[model samples]
Target: MARKASTRRRPRSGSSYRRVKKRSCYFCDSKISYVDYKDITLLRRYISDARAKIRGRRSTGNCQRHQNAVARAVKNAREMALLPYTNQ
Candidate 1:
């Protein structure tokens, strides 16, 4: 015979790491109208530690619009020698 599913409310796993809050876009929250390619300090935070590449939208918590801006800015910074293309 097939078993019927229980209707009782169950508690989630007690994993603290699973309780993380969603991150908002930094530029959007800061109300920054434009992303400057020359801002190396600010741009550095958006780069990955291992590959020295621009972070992805999921990791950076950036929306589509701001993520695109960040990518363009990173590229420009690379071309201008402000940020390294790759880590040695």
Candidate 2:
């Protein structure tokens, strides 16, 4: 008598089985970095919907200190009108 071969199950359609990789913070890796509120271009990337919230360490791959700095800089930028208070 012949044995039947085992079949692997297929994943469901439109389902994603892989974990998405998190992005790293640009500043932390550079090391010579200092976050300045005055740098509008630099601060804009972190802002979402015209408000800045420090991205999670896993998401941005930034250390706690740098994330705090990013938040501070974003606030200052908003106050100074370098960045908008809310997205239009």
Candidate 3:
């Protein structure tokens, strides 16, 4: 009598990175709200560390129009000392 071969499942190798859901822009999802330069707390979240630069649309998940608004707001806040021009 011939013996049958065993059936075994193989495990995956290498990276185990998980796919995350696409994030919506805070300003858009919340509502058609305006970006206020005086809102230091809100603006802080959009600024990058080390250089204190405004985050790009890709990372912020913002549309082009909103990104421009955010940039303008951040710049205004920086001029008013509400935010630092650069991280130091």
Clashes (N, CA, C under 3 Å) per candidate: 0, 0, 0
For residues 25-83, write the lDDT of model 3, one tens digit per residue: 88888896799899888888899998998888778888888889999999988889889
**lDDT value, residue 57 of candidate 2:** 66
Give model 2's TM-score versus the native structure: 0.63
Q: Which one is best on TM-score? A: 1
**Local error of candidate 1 at 63, Å?**
1.3
- Candidates in order, TM-scores: namely 0.78, 0.63, 0.73
The order by descending TM-score is 1, 3, 2
lDDT of 2 at 83: 77
**Local distance difference test, each candidate:** 0.90, 0.73, 0.85
Candidate 3: what lDDT?
A: 0.85
Cand. 1 TM to true fold: 0.78
Worst 10 residues of 2 by lDDT: 48-57
Ranking by lDDT: 1, 3, 2
- 75 in model 1: Cα distance from truth in Å? 0.2
